[model samples]
Target chain A: MDKPALAAWLGAEITGMALLSGGAIQQNWALDVLAGGQAQRWVLRTDAAATLAVSRSRAEEFHLLRAAHAAGVTVPEPLRLCTDRSVIGAPFFIMRRVDGLAAAHRVVRSETLAGGRQALVAALGRELARIHSIVPPRADLPFLGEPASDPCRRFVAAMRVLLDAGRLPRPMLEWGLRQLEISAPPPAATVLCHNDFRTGNYMATEAGISGILDWEFAAWGDPHEDIGWLCARCWRFGGPGEVGGVGPRAPFVAAYEAASGRRVDPARVAWWEIAAAIRWAVVAIDQAERHISGAEPSLELALTGHIVPELELDVMRAVMARAA
Target chain B: MSWDGHEAPDTRALLEIARTTLMEAVIPALTGDARFKALMVANAMAIARREDGPAAAAVHAAVRELGDVAALCAAIRAGAHDPGSADHDRIAASLRALAEARCRISAPKALG
Candidate 1:
């Protein structure tokens, strides 16, 4: 579709257009518009020409945003969803623009941002707690409810399927299965978990966290799963300290504990951290497959293959450390 | 051996060329592509730069360390120092301790 046509369809003056990023499923843009003679910036997310297999539909993603936002999680509000392919040649959605940075390397390296890292991390923990506090059975979201009985067992089984299909390293797969068998956490209160809770998935301002992004993987699970995922070393971007590379583990856990009135167990957290590494390793291998199959052929996907072994090593090291 | 001794170009050098081509050629032509495709290209370039630079050495060193740990575990299993009865748990624990120490001294550095 032409720019003029899109402008007419959106019913706003397109002042400036900047391409944000592209993935397998969608193209994101920072659309600067003059609406009612007032300048505003909004995010334009549209589907790719070649559809992706794993992406949720635009309507589903919008519904998830509304549900999560109404549950008091910090997420960008949905402005409008356009499913008319005639307008833009694909489905798209518009959301209120969120202000803050998402670059992981910049967050770790900028000395100016260093002081606020701890507070931001603490806020992240508290906000994650709030997200996990949502009662999935009561919510009207699509991907709610636990997966059968014994989520860990089912999770391990799913990983095994990926392992079999992807031909992942036997040692890492074996080690992960062994660890899961030995150190299964007792069941806890279930809630809506932002499965992709990590540093890059959040937008932060000096004041605090502004919004959480990426709800495609959100589901109902043990809340500590989110906590362990946040504190995982792979997501820390090499920053010193455990709390998402911002600071030590104690403060982040203390903040979460204070917010949710639950004790943070180091052993359980370590187990989940190991699980996080294994999960990332599996995803990295899958990304590599996507590149190899020419589904994406992205340098990110190619390089992701290299990180799997490192993650395996981390998983082994974490498990071993805890056993000691 | 010389730095260029290998017959095939090293992984780092190959990734460097790919990264350069992507940044200089591919990115400019990606303007009309969908947003997801453009983001993938950008992320690919970023990852390529990292792989061609510091990440190569980091991964190489890590692999070597893991190899060493495996060798140590084999030795312990073969009755060489007993590693306190030499169970899988004991071997894993010892390796973890070693890795933790290394992480303390040389934490993974960020991509600049």
Candidate 2:
């Protein structure tokens, strides 16, 4: 935004900066700088003008990145956080730039990028395990508030509020919530979960994961959620492999279990998978509502609503399987 | 383009033609983001075309007869239509049927 002021703040000569294509939630700029005659490449992340409700703020995300990076989670090395609005008009953070394919389709299909399917899947499982290694009640991540006492029921309650607010009644989502509410799991230990742990969110070169890119949705939740999210059908990009369309569920869970030293429960993961479907359905409707209500007229958002039926179908199948 | 009932193509037919042209001719020439946008346009056209006619309308009527979505959802939440109850099966069936109808228009491949 304000290049001169940013340069002064960093005390580095800004050679070039260009906005990256992704990050609808946040605006990412690929930046190059010459600091003390040393060339450096980095990415700057800042909040978009119209922010979504669920994601953490730039300041909060910085804390999350710090914690995640500290815990050995494969994330971009969070370098500096500029909180002064005057420097760039909004809070922004800079991190090391990672090069790899993060596109969902490409990441799922590319032989070169994904490396070996089992190896990559195992690596991702280990990455998720590292993310979950960061337990709650940490002083650094105070912005996350408190861990959900019962993440499943908490999600169901929140989804009900959102579904009602949608105005256009979604019976399918309601049904799924009803099923989820009754089947709420007993409270267990909470861990820091990457709520959006799916294919497109992480970058990898060959078989080695460069970094986990999206951190805005990181919060204290059930570890199974991140697991289910990774295994969620909607996130598969039509690839048949169970783990982000990369491999089967058994090895992924085995890897997570071996890495995290926590028992991986298939039933709990199944329940959260339903929650994931409902969660995406709610978000898809909300995104589409932005277009439908004329708040944001974009073809992408408009077509997002059409995806609800498929997600709803997913919910029904999963919920029914969990039924009496 | 008169509505003179003299072999006039319906709106659904027009949308089908547009989507077919987009998929077969126009979209093949597009790449990257432009191609993605064209695919979305084609998908929207297909959805709109399928949403027309009595088959789609009949689903609304059937679901309405079962009850509005809100009431049905409320009933579900209250546990009035418990799992094995007659009303549970009926309501679930109706909702499933409605969802399937929506899939027919929005994402038929997703149904199977």
Candidate 3:
């Protein structure tokens, strides 16, 4: 849409605009505007064409966001959701603009931010514990499903589908399947898991975590899945001795244990961490397919493809080590 | 230089060529496409640049070192090295050694 049309629709004069990173499923924008001569900022999130396949509809995402917010997870407040494709050529949602930073690389490496890394990681663990405490609605949330007894089985099944589709490494497939059989974690109480909880998906300031962003992958599952994912090595950027590339694993786990009043099982967390690596590998391949299939020829997807082997190696090494 | 006999060029070599093409060819041609298309190209470029610049070398070095650790484990299993009789402790020591080795490799220049 043109600037004038967007201004008319938003009822504000747009002063500055910056395009945020667009994922496979959504286009995001940072819009600075003036209303009644007072400056305001809002995030404009719109669906990308490819996102229609794997994503919940805008209405569903909005509803889920509302539910999650009500359950007390820190998130950007939803303002308005517009499903009219005529306005912007896609469904879009507007939300209150959040301040602070989201770039993981910057946060992990910067000396200024490095000092607070431990505190931030601990805070993140507590926040995740809180999110997992939310009870799934019996019927109102139609999309939420029961937690599987063996998430590894589900992962293996999904990987088989992808492998059968071709373009995936056979060795990695075999290795993952073997690992799944040998190193599966014991089942625990199912709870709401922010499936994509990681460094890049969160907003942070000097004080600590402000909000967790990106809810497209949220689901009902083993809560420890989120914990392990948060500590996955891939998400650690380049920071050594840090779980999420922020701080040591002990503090992160300790903070969660203290907050939730439950013993954090190291073995279970390790299992999920390995699973997290495998999941990333699968997602990386999907991103590569997006480029190779001509749906969206992105260097990002191609680069993402390169990481699959590394991820596969991590998964193999972790699982093998655990088995031994 | 070849660790596991895979004939394909290492990730570093492959990504350098791809990154060059992306920056010199693809990014400049992204005008007038749908917003999503443009975004995809841009995101792709970011990933390519990151891989070409830092992640490729870092991951390659890490993997090669891990392979060495695996070889060490094999040696210990064959009784070539006295890593102790306890299998669990042997594996744990090997892993710790690998982690320390990885930490010594200078942080990727590009990531800096």
Return the DockQ of model 2: 0.73
Residue A251 lDDT (model 3): 81
Where's the lowest-lDDT run of ten residues in candidate 2 chain B? Answer: B1-10
lDDT of 3 at A159: 61
Candidate 1 residue lDDT tens string, B1-112:
5665676766666766776776677667666445446556555555545545654565456546556544543353334533245466544644444443333323332111
- For candidate 2, the TM-score of chain A alone versus the native chain A is 0.97
After superposition, the stretches of candidate 2 with alpha carbons farther than 4 Å from their true spots are B1-7
Most lDDT-accurate candidate: 2
Considering only chain A, what is the TM-score of each predicted structure? 0.91, 0.97, 0.90
Instruction: Name the TM-score of candidate 3.
Output: 0.72
For model 1, what is the alpha-carbon lDDT of residue A254?
75
10 residues in a row with least lDDT, candidate 3 chain A: A168-177
Give the higher-TM-score candidate: 2 or 3. Answer: 2
Per-residue CA lDDT of candidate 1, range A216-266, in tens?
677777777888888898888877757776666766777788887877777
**Candidate 3 C-alpha lDDT tens digits along A22-55:** 6677788888999889998888888766773545
Candidate 3 residue-wise lDDT, B62-95, digit = tens: 4454455444433433344322345535444444
- Name the top TM-score candidate: 2
iRMS of candidate 2, Å: 1.1
Poorest 10 consecutive residues of model 1 chain A by lDDT?
Answer: A167-176
